[model samples]
Target chain A: MSDRMGEFDLIARYFTRPAKRAVLGVGDDCALLQPAPGMQMAISSDMLVEGRHFFAGVTPFTLGHKALAVNLSDLAACGATPTAFTLALALPRVDEAWLQGFSSGLWALADAHGCELIGGDTTQGPLNICITVFGEVPRGQALLRSGAQADDDIYISGTPGDARLALDALRGTLALPTELLAQARARLEQPSPRVALGQALRGIATAAIDISDGLAGDLGHVLEASGVGARIDPEIATNLIAGCAHAAAAAGLFPYEKLLEYVFAGGDDYELAFTAPPAARQAVDAASRKSQTQVTRIGSIEKAPGLRLVDAQGRSVTQTFQSFDHFA
Target chain B: MSDRMGEFDLIARYFTRPAKRAVLGVGDDCALLQPAPGMQMAISSDMLVEGRHFFAGVTPFTLGHKALAVNLSDLAACGATPTAFTLALALPRVDEAWLQGFSSGLWALADAHGCELIGGDTTQGPLNICITVFGEVPRGQALLRSGAQADDDIYISGTPGDARLALDALRGTLALPTELLAQARARLEQPSPRVALGQALRGIATAAIDISDGLAGDLGHVLEASGVGARIDPEIATNLIAGCAHAAAAAGLFPYEKLLEYVFAGGDDYELAFTAPPAARQAVDAASRKSQTQVTRIGSIEKAPGLRLVDAQGRSVTQTFQSFDHFA
Candidate 1:
């Protein structure tokens, strides 16, 4: 005989809670939500798979955090306020310990953002976590990738390559000191979603996108949508990598060329890349200070048709970096 | 070199389309939805896995239809008007033919309901389809499981046991004629969510739930939520099975007892189970005619604490049935 709990029991133990902001919550056929008057709803979904998104033996706690964080990142990119989310999970078995840790980590981030888990589904299958998040933004104030204009100064929030550095170190393709590896691993595992900064950037940043599939690739999306090109200062772009300022003094540091690749095409970095008019530079600084997140200017939107990597003196910098694609 | 399509190309070819109703659609970080003024959004998520939810060799078209249909069924249960949905899919490999069939089937149902495909994520992994659907209902008009009252009449939309019959036949446990099997298979595959019927019953029905986990189990949910019991006429309940009316005259028909079991405990029946005050029976009939969906009354809600199957003369009929549970 075995004492395995049923699906309903598992959900009641770990997932079910009283509705806070949602009109209706778990146990209902559909959760009900009423956004404030005249507010538009923003929706985004992300799926995380074992072995493809993370290592097989990774901790469930961080896995839960990362699953919801990637989705919240999209809301942040849209300059929307976090509201609610639904999680559809497929698990191979019912391990109570794993469930306890996973739900704990999930609630920690959810509570911080005031995003409630309204409703979801769980079934026995291969491990997959798909989260669809709902947020709210005032009409016409939400940021979009198609809003960039020529002469807008491009910017990035936080270090964008630290997660990739940690990934490479763990994958054994590169090496890092134990202390630095710990710092980078945290970036890979529990990267913060800049919800406050995104809200602060409303009406200020011309366009924005979260760096998930590398800075260069995601920025390419913004460029294509806005029908504008960008001239990124390679020197400044490479300087956005974590530990880049101390690279010369640090032993076992990778070369600047490799650092450029990490910054340009490293995936899993949940930082924002955005653009604003030069006249709004002070306003952007105020937003950055208000949200307590660092912002770095790295380039400018141009009327040209393609991305150009340039030096401090505007000399062409020759390089090629492929963005991460799941099926390429 | 191989000529496999990348994820973006696949999405553009098969998934991406113009934003018909959404403020922003595919290709953006998130889709924007503006529900009609004075409407509350109803949301639900469902996940289907290959081999567990469907046979490995099942047609991709039907898989697509079933995935979205099941999620829509939740909206229907809540008396919400279908608005849009996000699809999160993971495929083992890129199969052009499969993608063509799947997206076609998806759009066929989506177009019928005017539910646009808003935003989603696709990745490489074990095949899993997770869809989160959104719908709108006027405030205070949503049908909920907790609204059933004592002496309310219980009703079910359409037949409930045909899908289970088809499943049993496909599993080789039951025998069915070629033509009859095809009829049942369609019921098992592409279930028509009672969206119109749900809306028609908005003010008439007191409590509602879509029969996903068998008629007995789902009704149990309603009973538990409303703190009421139900007394179902065994004869009337068995008559709910498809072809049950012709069962006595037909050869190759299963016993009446088995039919009762099927109607009572069979799962995957997306038809709705609902209740209304006995005084509103005529109004319920008018709704049934308006929605063009048949409704059958088989029982009455009572203040008692448990379900009881009774004969036409009100004598108790002894039987036991367990509902399907994914992890039980």
Candidate 2:
């Protein structure tokens, strides 16, 4: 890769490989893709700027991987199979080592999901990475946030909040045991996109969203879009942040209940939060089993206008949750 | 569309609209598009950073217009039909006025091109705008730089160097009469994309590229890709600068010859540079007539290995052109 070389040279060296899966790839005025017959193209974009989205001294490899991963997460939420992506990058200066690591990290995830780097623009500016990913789903079968029904059960794939816990640990607001810290840090840096699970659950999933700005906030989007409310089980929700007590103990919390905040409100988990009809529970379980991803039914959609937290016995709880807001 | 408001609310208020063309639109995990049958999807991305790409005093409306325009220029170069786009914006704060103007400018051009705002991400950070545009072309019909051949006529659309002259004027490096300055400034802030001309040129223009980093540098890309050289006519190239003679006179140049630099090396022209076989001259003229855009033949492709500048006579001219370099 020509990271430290001239900008066009860098693109030629790294981003300009021949278009294999793509109808046309890098080096043209634009890249071309051919979606499968009778399919809809799913498109999503995400931007990450240095010092805001990432800490100083973070490796470029992690930055590249996370940049594309975030956009892919949106595709996974829509149950689309990854196809292609374009990157627009602004670099402070050409650093060969950084570019090599970054491109390696980027291509690893892209190749794993069969996503091709189609076209991109690289320029001289402050460090920023923006990626737009494209995927495809069968017409009328793709999942969406507005399709949830009042009686549908809300489920999340894999785990949530570990990335937030890692953020908290890095910020020194919380202390974590070695094992937990390592696990959380990994999640923070390289959270997996639930693409296989999302595709597998397509028709079975009534509505879907990737848990990003915390379960409380992101689910709020589902509620807003689907015109439905939700009542989440706090007991099961707390289990989502299992083993975080070790971190709370390390921090010497008096009530030891602060761990619950991460459970309900921590963002960046990159997990899939979907709703499925109760009658389709077997199908949902089967899809999750096929993808080898753990599916947790943590709540039920309701006709009410807002979200709620309930005790295991179904009594209302008085806990407030916060969503991660870029502005707030 | 959301320039200054709270991110999600801003999106809901301004960008969340029903997709008349897209299968899915805003408020979902991803927006979905279905290319017409037997068509390939053409995709391109561009990133514009505040200060690096534009002056601070420029309006959000102009910023919005230019961001999309540059990407559309790529579509024009590829002879792709404008279809859809995604915008990822980073802003410092929510300013209702700015968002309104920006969205207004953005939509004006979008509607004119029939391009839909598909999906995007908005976040808090240093001000930056990244857009990825999608288009469509019949399979195997895309105009590529690599398709240019020896003996092809090299052509450009509209004007070049006016934007660079505007840039120099903004930097106080040149002076111009008010009328001249205003015209140049319009070219800088709101250069039009030759979308129709591009679509019409398909199957006629052998190869094409958009003049972005200056004719000299951008044409270098086409030449490098096509493995051919060029001999540009100085008389015709000089006329491409149009009314810049007043600025050169104001700058106290002997016989006002400095205008040539702006013609050859000035960047941000956003015009098309294309190649066509001499035999297709009649068809090229018909395409230009159909698109109602001016097309100029400025040079000829050659079997030689480097670009050469020629006088009104056939002999070569000893001259130099400077490209806009971000790092330099």
Candidate 3:
């Protein structure tokens, strides 16, 4: 690659281009962009380390996509449309193959979402990827967790616990059917962000968040933000995990009442959990139909703070809330 | 510290705050921001890796400030007013003192520029800092290097070579006068970006770029972008270096053309270099007065496509055009 071109030449070759609505693109010292009219910019960042965020053996393509996807998930939770992004890649060396794959993966997503890759920096170090994404939402119309009110219906899109189970299967801690293994591996490799569902819920949903750090922990964020409580049906959460026997068996490893723990506390689901007012239920349904996104109402918001889980028999289920913790 | 909170809590403590024009800062999944009316958003990102951007022993405060400053320099080059930023920091371990100092230094510059720390992510790894800064300029008014025309007057802000001298002193390759040494150290620790000067050039400058990768290399960028050439006087560059020799001599370095090379090829000056039509020269001066910034006419754009350095006697000088190569 060095024989072909230098760093600046490489940047100009693959990264510099004008995008629709971009006031300024590459070649300038920085990019100047116009945010969508009447919209506020939604911004989020995520950093993936060599060992902490992914295995060292993971391809740069997956690494690049996942890095951007994680941050995009944040934008999706806020009902924002992806617009632009900056990347910071620290590498041990300039691996040509790695860069090609990484750039291709990043560009694929960027093009698909109409998000332009604007600015970035590259440096020498152990591999690390940091991506900051910008999105736009109508002013005063962002879906925030603070809007969840008592008695509002709580809904989640897509399946949870699968990604976590996939990780377990990868670690050889669990056995899975061949077809299930393929599905789990795919989920691990390329988790989808609920962008469409989030945008659909823009006006109708009272509050929303992406299930990143498991349902319980992420829901805790909503509870803290909205100053409310939630009583989720443990059976519903358990049944979600029971869809896969390997995950169900993994759940059996925990205490009897804690089978819902993985669904509630496991992270990296990248699914949206939202709250909608009783009056907007019809609108929410309409949005689900329009967006073709599944919306499952699993609980109701309460005036009291903290989370409670009830079994099918309506008995309180006591369980340990163990999920992904940054330090842990 | 881990005892206090997790990554999210740490972000809340250090990186979240209301910034100028920020509608919502740091609490939601993504920040909600508003750019100044009639202005476009200028965005830039820079990543600093340990042992690559700075020495491993450097203070976290200086590192943090430098990370933000480098990106702001890009905005300043574009004649944009710094508005907001997001930081991505990867560390091998949590060090509370380091975080405190780093955050304090970062906030110092942010507050001064009326920029808010809107969003960020923190994770574990070898120390890597990625900062994305936002600035605003009037619509269709961003200064671009591609706008430079042949026969345009070339100008730069402030002096060069100080940062290089400081780096030399820091590496023990040079000795300097005590006062000059302190000043050079300050240049390295808290390099001032010519934001006002860039903003002053908004309407007057035909083309512009920030002198981060030395005068020669960065000017080459403008030349290439504008499809023009430049003839810089070597004596003028040498004299500029001569003026800084007291510091260099005090730092125990030779007062020779090598010093000039650093000024011409050494990077990280964070000064603006721009071209302006003859008719706009007076207006440029008026803008300088209005913004309380100095504008130094350095050279002239030429019809040719290659860069040349000529002596007072009009003889071409042989000098290697070098700058900071990120990959190298």
Best by DockQ: 1
Report lDDT (Cα) of residue B102, candidate 1: 95
Cα deviation of B61 in candidate 1 (Å)? 1.1
| Candidates 1 and 2, the one with greater DockQ | 1
On a 0 to 100 scale, what is the lDDT of residue B211 in model 1?
Answer: 93
Task: Kindly indicate the candidate among 1 and 2 with the higher lDDT.
Answer: 1
Candidate whose TM-score is highest: 1
Q: B222, model 2: CA deviation in Å?
A: 1.1
Candidate 1 accuracy as lDDT: 0.89
lDDT of 2 at A75: 93
lDDT score, residue B245, model 1?
A: 22
> Chain B alone: TM-score in each candidate?
0.97, 0.94, 0.93
- Model 1 residue runs over 4 Å out of place are A1-3, A240-252, B1-3, B244-252
Residue A312 CA displacement from its true place in model 3, Å: 3.0
Q: Check candidate 2 and list the clashing pairs.
A: B4-B94, B4-B95, B5-B94
Cα lDDT for residue B146, candidate 1: 97
What's the candidate order when arranged by decreasing TM-score?
1, 2, 3
Clashing pairs in model 1, backbone N/Cα/C closer than 3 A: none
Error of 2 at A104 (Å): 1.6
